[model samples]
Target: MSTLVAERQLVADACRVLAARGLADGFLGHVSLRVDDERLLVRCRGPQERGLRWTTPEDVHLVTLDGEPGDDGELGEWAPPNELPLHAEVLRTRPEVSAVVHAHPPAVVTADLAGLAVRPVVGAFDMPGTKLAAGGVPVYPRGVLVRDRRLAAEMVAAMGNRPVVLLRGHGLTSAGASVPEAVLHALSVDRLARLELAVVSAGGTLVDLPAEDMAELPDLGAGFNHATAWRHELANLP
Candidate 1:
C-alpha cells in the first residue's frame, strides 16, 4: 500500500477504536497519524455521531506540521478541530511519536477540574518515561483557541519526550511510536485517572512510586491490549 493509504487506514482505525471506547464522544476528540515531512492525516472535524466507527480516507485531511490544512484546502463538509495545532506540535517535537490521540475522558477531566495532581503510581503500565517529558507536560492555561499557532508552539516545547500530556480543563494528549500505542496510552491515562479520582474521593492517602517500584514497573510495562480493548468498547458502543 502507498504511504498515504497506510496513513489513512491507520487514522480511520484509530477513530473507530477511540469512539467505540467512549473516549471520543462523537466529534469531541481527535486522532492523527504521521504521513511524512510537514504533514499528518487527521480526521476532519464535524457532523459525526457518537461512536462513529468508519471514517473514509476522504475524512482524513493531510495537514501541515504547523496544523495548516492541506492543498485540497478545507474539506467543504468538514474542518479540522480547533485542537489540530496540539497534534501538530506533538509530532514536530517528538519525532518518535508516529500517532497522537487526544480525548476528554471523564475521569481525567474530573481530576483536572478538581485541581488534583495526578501522578503515576507503581503499576505494570505506569512508567516514568510515559509521564515526564524532556521539559514535562506544561499545562497551557485554558483560553487559547485549540488551533492557536502560539499554543501549538507551546505544546511542542512542553511535551518534549513524554508519551502523554494533560491540557487543563480540556483533555489528555497521548502519543506513541504507532497508532495502536497512542491509543493504549490514552487508555492507560483513563484508567489511572479513574484511580486518582477514586483516591481523592475516598480521602485515602495515595502513595507515589518509590524508586524501586518505579524501576521495576518500567520493565513489566503494561503492554497495551489494543485489540481486546477495542473489541470490548465497540461491543458497548451506543
Candidate 2:
C-alpha cells in the first residue's frame, strides 16, 4: 500500500481501538492523521456506518486543513464530524502534531464533572499518566460541542503546547506526531481519570508525587511503546 493508504489504515485501526477501549461511544468520536502540512486523513461517518468500533479504511476520508475534502471526492455521502474544526485548527497551529484524537470517555467526563484533576499520585506504575501529570494536562473548562472555528480556536488556545486537553463534561483532544502516539495519549488520560475517581471513592486524598520525585523520573518522550500498545489493542479486537 502507498503511504496515504497506510496512514488511512492507521486512522481506521485507531478508531476501532478507541471504541474497544471504551474511550469512544458508537460514532461519537473522531480520529485524524496529518497527511501533510495542508491536509489530513480523518474518519468520516458513512451513510451505512453504525459505529467506530468496526471502522475500516474505507471509512477514512481526506480533507484539507480548512476541512475541505480532497480532489478524489471519495467522501460521497459521508460527512466529517462536526468537530472537524477541532482537528483542523490544531494541525494548522501545531507543526509537530501529525495525529489527533477526540473522544468522550466516561471516566474522563465524570472526573471533570466532579472537579477532579489528573495528577501524578500513582508514581511510575503508569508512564503515560505520570508523563501527563509532569507535562501538565490543561482543561478547556467548557462543556459545549466544538462545531465552529471560534470554539475550536478557543480550545486550541487552551491546549497551548500540551499534548492533551480535557473538554469539560464533553470529551478530550490529544495530538501527537503519529496515530499511535495520539491514541496512547487519549488512553492515558482516561486511565488517569479512572484512577483519580477510584482514589476519591475510597476516601483517599490525592497527594501528587513530589516535584523532586517527579524530577527524578526519566523522560521517555512522546510515542513511548506506541507499537506495543497498538498491537495489544488490535489483538483484543473481535
Candidate 3:
C-alpha cells in the first residue's frame, strides 16, 4: 500500500485503541500522522462518539503544516479537530516529529487538577514497551487553550526531545516519528501519570528516575495497545 494509505489505516486504528480505553470520549481527543514532510493525516472532528471500531481511511483528512485542510477534502471531508492548530503547530516546530496524539484520559487529567506532575520515576520514567517521556513531561501552567500558539510553543520548548507534554487543567500531547510511536508516548505518559498519583496517594513522593532506570524503560508499542486497556474499561463505561 502507498505510505498515505497505510498512514490512514494506522491513524484510524490508533483512534479505536484510544476510544476503547475511553481516552477519546466521542470527540474530545485527536490523532495525526505526518504522511508527508509538510502534511498530516488526522481524525476529522464530528460527533463525539466512543468505542470506534469502524473508522476507515476515508475518516482521515490531510492537512498542511499551517492547519489548512487539504484540497481533496473528500478523503475525509469531515472537519478536523479544533485542536488541529496545536497538531500542525507542533509538527511545524518539531521537525523530528512524524505523529502526534492528544487525549483526555481521566486519570491523567485528574492528576493535573490535583496539582500532580509527571517526573522521571524510573530513570526518567522509562518502562518496557513504553516510550518514556524523556526530559519528563512538563504540565503547562493553567489557563492556556490548546490552540494558543504561544502556549504551544512553550510546551514544545519544554518537551525538547521528550515524547509527551502534559497540559495543566487539560490533557496530554505526545509526538513520535510514526503514529504508533506517538501513541506509545501517550500511553507511557498515562501510565507514569497514574504512577505519580499512586505514589502521592501512599504519602510517597515522586522522585526522578535514575539514569539507569530511564535507559531500561521499554518501547511497548506506539500507543497501539488499546485492546488490552479497552477490555479493562468495559466495566467502567457509563
Q: State the lDDT of candidate 2 residue by residue for 85-161, as single tens digits.
A: 99999998899999999999999999988988877787777766786767788999989999988999999999999
Top TM-score prediction, candidate number? 2
Question: Each model's TM-score, in the order given?
Answer: 0.78, 0.94, 0.76
Top-lDDT candidate index? 2
- All candidates' lDDT scores? 0.68, 0.87, 0.69
Candidate 1 C-alpha lDDT tens digits along 1-238: 1337767766777787776666776567778888786878888765663333666566777777665665564555667777887888787777788888988777777776787655665355545333442123445556345676677777656555667777777787888887877887777666666787888788887676665765554333334355555455546544
Backbone clashes for every candidate come to 1, 0, 21
Question: Who is ahead in TM-score, 1 or 2?
Answer: 2
- Poorest lDDT segment (10 consecutive residues) of candidate 1: 128-137
lDDT of 2 at 123: 70
> Which stretch of 10 consecutive residues in model 3 shows the poorest summed lDDT?
124-133
Model 3 spans with C-alpha error above 4 angstroms:
1-3, 47-54, 73-77, 122-134, 148-151, 205-238
Worst 10 residues of 2 by lDDT: 219-228
lDDT value, residue 200 of candidate 1? 74
